[model samples]
Target: MFKILVIDRCYFTRTGMESWLNQTDLFPASFLVAALHNLMLAKEHIVQWQPDLVIADLHGFKNEIHHIQQLASLFSVCGDGIKVLLLESGEDAQLSDYFTQFNIEETLLKTASLDTLAQSIDAIVLSRPTRTEPKPAVPLLTRQEEKVLTLWMEGRSNQSIATKLSINGKTVYTYKRNIRMKLGMDNRFTPFLSLPDAIN
Candidate 1:
């Protein structure tokens, strides 16, 4: 079962996102945090819930793009397997390049229809590479591992991952090390650099 955390500032928006996720029939469970104030609380929420991915609402906040990048970086460094799906308005479309630089995945327009939203989520969560030619087999990841890998790909820090996984920081490091070894990314620099591709 895949678990997701929905973060948004407005009550109505947060509820709407959660409803949409529940309606998708994909995720087994979801944790909702509306009007998130402190970054520490966001970290704590991840640790407590250990969600597979995060759907972050980037609207109506100061330094919205920067905050999203910070969260993305935190998830990447940590061993949490969380991917961020940004919810943006048309006005914010200009910030796409900024998000790309940070390796944040795709963005969802705030005004998008429910069907469009569902398709976007499905694309992100259930995509797989097609086998048209001979290529190295992608590692098959367990649901839990995928969650951790998603966050790792987002550039969360080790301590952040530890908190999200409710495990010791060292344990987070060990999981990452093991993941790298299993994926044949055991080299230090290689693991860090190829992590995004490995997880995705």
Candidate 2:
């Protein structure tokens, strides 16, 4: 089975891509697909899920070159190598240089025909490295940590989360730290797309 992650801020696009890829007869392999409408949480998902291929829409990151760089860095160091297919808008033409710099070779314009999209995916899949062994699963967040993260993702302040959870403020902070650590986001300043906010 091939694991594929679709990252696009558009709900329709994410679902549409997943559906199309699954329904098409272009590839005989089975696909285990996951969709995310947030770019910020992509690294976390990618690391934990260890997808064989990632289809990311770069339209949202046009003005955020640093965010693209960050993503490129993650792909560079991914333990088991993976392939990426980036979707970009017309305005993203200038960003091609960044792709070349990061060795990201497969990219397709968002307005490209479905046939072209399928071709790009086929090319990537054909070139992807075969995995010899399964990666060990990453640790999951504890229930309390998940609760704290849900609240924090809703724009709650640390104190607000503490009050909501009926826990001490310090405990809430600890939970937040643990959540971040488990998600492989050690950098406190790394931006995250609030799931609820980004989904819509």
Model 1: CA > 4 A from native: 24-38, 63-80, 93-95, 128-200
Candidate 2 lDDT over residue span 106-187, tens digit each: 7787899998887777777666655555454342665677577657766677777788889999998788777777666765
lDDT string for model 1 (1-200, tens) is 35556666566776766666665364433323222322434555555555455666655543533445655544553252556677765456545655565545567778878777666666665543222332221224444554566567567776776677777878767777766665555565444334432222
Instruction: Indicate the residue-level lDDT of 159 in model 2.
Output: 76
In candidate 2, stretches whose alpha carbon ends up further than 4 angstroms from where it belongs are 24-26, 63-68, 78-80, 129-175, 185-200
In order, the Cα lDDT scores of the candidates are: 0.54, 0.68
**Clash counts for all predictions:** 17, 0
Instruction: Go through the candidates in order and give the C-alpha RMSD of each one to the true structure.
Output: 12.7, 5.6
